[model samples]
Target: MLTQEDNTLLTRTGPGTAMGALFRRFWQPVALSRELPEPDGPPMRLKILGEDLRAFRSTDGTVGLVSPRCPHRGADLFYGRNERNGIRCVYHGWKFGTDGRCQELPTMDSGPAREKAEQNVRLNAYPTREANGFIWSYLGPPGQVPPFPELEFTTVPPSHTYVSKKLQQCNWAQACEGGLDTAHFSFLHMALDDGEDATAKLLTKVSSNTDTVRWMRNDGAPRFTILDHAAGLILGAARRGDPNENYWRISQFLMPNHGLTPNAFPGENYHGQCWVPIDDVSCWIYNYTWNPDRPLSNAERDRFANGSGIHAEVDAHYIPIRRRENEYLLDRNKQKYETYTGIDGVSEQDACIQDSQGLIADRTTEHLGPTDMGIIRFRRLILDSAKALAAGDPPRALNHPAAYKVRGGGAVAPATQSLPEVLQARFGT
Candidate 1:
């Protein structure tokens, strides 16, 4: 549990806050690449880390993330025309390029005054890059931008990955903690009273095999072993399995707000999520699934698109179909017989519970246990980083970008094996 002061520092990430400053040191995804499908397309309004901005693709196919308000008369750039390698304000003929350079000031005559105004009147723009089907931007101070982390999904071919985002009506920290707390799988994502065969069938619908489901169901209290690495922490939860083997679910928690799931065995599609804060009480959960060995099949893509595993069935606006506004379409009868939460999708179930923890979870009035070691360590790591940043020391993860190339997954080993040995056996690190 945390004191109220610590919780405040952990949750609030607006501009000028210590947590916000720490997040600014890293690159953050602002929009999906498909959101700006064609060159010179319409600008999309984006709000990340409580800062309102606009994103557009230039004629050269490069993405531009700049201030949404025009510097001339505070007009919104969403209505501006994207053409000829720049965004032209519809209110006036002023045009700005992807680098925020004032290109043309047609309203002002081509005189000395016009040239000076064109040079001085520039919009604030952040550097952007497209990777892994997402448009990422560095919102920190100029010249201090760090290199992008070598996430495995972003390093793979487009055909080998699928990416999507959904809105979550809760604080980013709590939603992120839910992803790292793998011990909840035994109850939160399991069947209640369904027979073994029916439970296996339901689990299969969510992309898990019967062996994993059985191991999770049989061992509700998993022994945990955590290891600290350069980029982040490796969390391994060992559960009793068949005769001489222990089922190990290993997960990775990267700096800032990224978590790699532990459901995939070898050859299965790997999954991960990044909880980008939209504000103090809302967030956008970006989900990525990739198969490093080969390209994802059409059926697999279709299943992900229609809501399977971590992917939620989202509307055109990327909001989940069953959300807080509709009580997540909960069915009491289904809860009593079909599933534990009466939720149809695993992502929906996660959202439902995490949101139910209130806008920002009150850690001051909570009780934590062994299963919560991952959550505890996560809070410590981030809070310490935030404090260190406040003291003028940058996070070490920023300097070790290549360390982010690690992977996390499941494996079966002897109970005597150590966490490092388990990781070596599974990921060959």
Candidate 2:
């Protein structure tokens, strides 16, 4: 458990905060690429890391992330007209380009005086990159911006990937730690009193192998082995399997706030999530399911679109249909008869519990055990990185962009085999 001071250091990520500074150094997904479906489309209202911003797709198809308020008269850019190649504030006909520099200030005549005022009066803008259905922006010191981590999902063909984002109404750290804490899968995702095939029935869409489900159900207490790497940590949890074999669920925790789930088998879809903080109390969980081997089929895509695995069924605004206001639509009868939590979807179950940990979990009051090793290391990594950045040192993950290409999945190996050997046998890393 963290002390009160350490907990504060971990949760608060507003501007000027140590954690916020560390997050800003890395590229963050500010909006989905599809949000601004076309050039000169409406701008998106964004509030990331406690900063109000706006995102727009320019005529060249490049994305722009800038302060929402027009510097001219403090008018909100959400009401601005996206015309030509820039956002023109209707308040006074002030046009700002994707770079946030005033492109045209109609209030002043087009002359040396106008040019000087236009150049001097500009909105705060950050750099943006569009890849794999996301509009990512770098919001740190211009000199300190690192190369984007080429996450495997973003590198795949568009047809092979399905990306979505849902509002997670809780602190970013707790939701993130939930992803790294694979031990909860044994209970949180289990179907209670549903006979011998209960586990299989519940996780059929998540894990193709029924035996893997059985292993997860039988061994609630998985032995963990964590390995540190350039991008983040490789968390390996081993559960007892049939005979001499052990079922290993290996996951990846990338940098400050990304987690790759371990449910995929060879030829199956790989899944990951990025918890980009909207504020200290909430975050947008950007989720992706990608097949590295081939394109996703229409049926598979439809299933995901309707809510399956990590994908939640969200409304047009990207808010989950089953959310906090509705108590995640809990059904006690279903809890007693169907699944353990009475929650219909895996994503909803996760959200229901994480949000229950208060707006922010008070780590100072909790008890932690060995199974929480991944959670512990995750906190240590980011907390330490935050402190190190404060001391004028940068994180090592920023230097190894290619390391983000690594994958996480399940494997079956001898109980005597080490995690390294299992990783080799499964992924040939």
Candidate 3:
């Protein structure tokens, strides 16, 4: 169980809190590409990762994220009109651009007086960028925000990409942790289809001091080359005739509030989607369908649409605002959705497990060992750096880039496929 102090570290979104500080270091997705397909109308209101902000594309195709409330009378920016150049606040006719710089004060005389005041007062605006079919915003300190990583999935042809979204009620951290918990894949996504499946169990479990537990590639390869890690992370490069093998699986967490997991199909197809949080407790999972040539098979496409399979029923009853407080206080506390399957026969899959675990986990009480390496390291980075930022220190990952080589540090490669000989011998297909 997490103590009050532990909760303080995890739940607080102030400058130095564990999760908040960590999230501030990256450029997070604020909205989907379709949100601003055209440069028209009032700005779109979006709350991404955790911050409340407004977004809109310019007539010239540039997207901007700015403060939601007017710096003057505190009017909401969503109601403002989008002109060719900037957003004009209907409340006071104060106009501003994507840069958060005040461009005009219609009521004031058109003179240097208005220009001086506008120059002195600037509304907070976050840096915005678009990538992989999503609008991304950097909410952290400008200097510390890291460059987005260049994953191999993005290099594939546009025909391979696909998109989709789902709604959840939970904090961004709770949602993100699901992706890092590699143990759950075998249990949650239980290999109901893989031909050479090793993890078909109904439930997946692990411990810190793993001896009997095998964590390695079946080939007995070098530790660094194999997907052998305590964190349950399995990665490998693409191999010919492999089970949709590629340089990477394209599964990654955007930190704090969002994650991306790409699933590949047999027809040379791929789908990259994102799980975006609606608030501290609710999220919207989105999919960007990248496939342009071949259409998805019925079964393959259905897999993505099944709604976190066996988990949706439990999520229906979740009320984040009410349960948020008690979540952090209990251990072994199954989220309300974790156990609540609707009479219609559905179970809460990933969403319930994380949220019900606690709105915010008491990290100190977490018995993290190896399987949780990714999550553990991620949290530490978040808390420590957030603490540093709170202390007015520079943010970490300030020089983050989209593409960088991972040398000798033992990164996981994508999964491989069973040989044709084995398949023929076993099934005679």
TM-score of each: 0.98, 0.98, 0.63
lDDT of each: 0.91, 0.91, 0.49
Report the C-alpha lDDT of model 3 over 60-81, residue by residue, as the tens digit.
7888788789888899989989
Candidate numbers, best lDDT first, in rank order: 2, 1, 3
lDDT of 2 by residue, 1-429 (tens): 999999999999999899999999888988888899999999889999999999888999998889999987799999999998999999989999999998888888778998789769988899999888988988999877798898999899999999999999999999999999999998888887454476676688798888876787789989899999999999999999999989999999999899999888899899999999999999999999999999999999899999898899999998999999999999999788867898888899999999999999999988889899889999999999999999999899999899999898999889899999999988888
Task: Provide backbone clash counts, one per model.
Answer: 0, 0, 40
Better of 1 and 3 by lDDT: 1
CA lDDT, candidate 3, residue 272: 32
- Against the correct fold, how does model 3 do in TM-score? 0.63
- lDDT string for model 1 (1-429, tens) is 999999999999899999989999999888889989999989999899999998899999999999998899989999999999999999977899999999988888889999899889999999999997989999987999998999999999999999999999999999999999999989888887555675787677644668988889999999888889878999999999898889999999999999999878888889999999999999999999999999999998998899987999999999999999999999999888878898878899999999999999999998999989999999999999999999999999998999888777889999889888988788888
TM-score of candidate 1 versus the correct structure, residues matched by position: 0.98
What TM-score quantifies how close candidate 2 is to the native fold?
0.98
Q: What count of clashes does model 1 give?
A: 0
lDDT of 1: 0.91
Q: What is the lDDT, from 0 to 100, of the residue 122 in candidate 3?
A: 66
